[model samples]
Target: MRIARLGPRGAEVPVVLHDDRAHDLRGIAPDVDGAFLGGGGLDRVRDALAAGDLPELEGADALRIGAPIARPGAVYCIGMNYAAHAAESGSAPPERLVMFMKSPNTVQGPDDDVEIPRGSVKTDWEVELGVVIGTRTSYLRSPEDAWAHIAGYVVADDLSERDWQLAESGGQWSKGKSAPGFCPTGPWLVTPDEIDARAVRLRSRVNGDPRQDSSTADLVFGIDRILYELSQVLVLDPGDLVLTGTPEGVALSGRFPYLAAGDVVELEIDGLGRQRHRFVAHEDAPEVAGA
Candidate 1:
């Protein structure tokens, strides 16, 4: 089943997407968040659908669509998981998994305006397949168990600023990765049964120019291994998001220019969904509560 949140940011209500329409799911749970998923909410949603209990959400299409899920507990990312991406970055394929974190506050709706950080140059885009965890996972026994822990998937743009990531932050990528509104995710979340995370084609475009075009098949370390490997080191909780990494074509590859104010970024993964974000100068954004 596809799930989403609709309304203004911070006040989004849960809904289920059906045939290009949204059906209210707030009666089933407050939101399609970690707590709801951890407490057997998906099962409840399935049951409700079977019973035809959900109400069609009126005016849903007119309301703003927020991120499919609320701010997750942690936003983990895999670095250079795609072999082609590693090659473009002037790095050899690593023998083991390389991971990083984005501040949870960076998470925003798919259509939200992305802020180019103050005094920034080299801000970039990464279109990635995002895995949303459904269960508490720690010390998982085998790679085979990985799929069971995933709740669903979403489209994620792992926005970055090269300056903070590589040159000035003491080699820590998260410094550049965690700016507010850097992570724009989801028009909706698609369940595992509906999408193949391993073989889907994911791509990105800046303004109107094509920039990235690749499949998850190029990943050096696929989902199963990444999950198994990470479980050994850290506990992944429900509603935690894992950005599986981007492909070769990105601003970081030096083939394209860094994103500028008023530039539009569009990204999509086959069967999962798509996202479009407009880049805005830092000074142009209004001050909000979280800022």
Candidate 2:
């Protein structure tokens, strides 16, 4: 089942897609936040959908999609999890995973235009695989247990700024990452049961040229281990998003080109769906408090 939240940004209603038609469940009982994939929610909805219990959505074409998960408790990211990406930045693979946070407010619809922050010139992009957690979890010993916590997956573009990340009064990498509207995710949430993730190919392009090209098979820390490692320190709650880390071919990687104003960004993953957004100059934004 492909689950999505569609409509206007703040007013998106939960709906499920089957047979290439949208279904509106305006008052059904399933909320995208939780219970959509847990406590027999998917089964009940799937049965209802198969039995024709759901009606078609009113306006599918014009609806803007919100990030699939409703209210994520946190947005956890893995840094330098891809070898070539680490090498591109002229560093060695870390002894352990490097984790950081991107405030949940940064979440936006997959197609939303990324606002370049004021007084910034080094805005950049990273295409990553985002894992949505289905259940609450803590420390686990092995990789197998990690799979139990994941609800599904979606494509995420982890936008960034190079100057704030390294050259500024940097304390943590999150400084550059937590800017408003920095994370664009989810045209659709593809459940793990419906797709194969082990060897899936992922790619991202800036404007028309391909900038990032790599396979999940190249990840330094695979999905299972990442969850197990993270669970040790923080409790993984339902609706929390875990970015699986971007593969090689980002501006930090140095081989690919950097993003600039008016450049279009496109991210695609097999089965999960594709999402596109454009980058704009910081100076083009409206004058505000800091301006």
Best by lDDT: 1
TM-score of each: 0.98, 0.93
RMSD of each: 1.2, 3.0
TM-score of 1: 0.98
- Per-residue CA lDDT of model 2 for 1-291, tens digit only, reads 888888766678778888888887665754577655556566677788878989998878678877777767799999988888888778898779899998888888788777788777778888899998888879888889988888889889888888887788367888889787788988888888888776788898888788888888888999998999999999988788999888778877666656777888999988899899877776664332100
lDDT (CA) per prediction: 0.89, 0.81
Q: Please write out the lDDT profile of model 1 over residues 1-291, one tens digit for every residue.
A: 998988988889899887676889989898878999888888898888888899998998798878898989999999998888999999998788999999988888898888899999999999999999999989889998999999999999999999999999897889999988989989888999888888999989888788889999889889989899999999999999999989988988988899999999999899978889898999997553221
Pairs that clash in candidate 1 = none
Given candidate 1, what's the lDDT at residue 225? 90
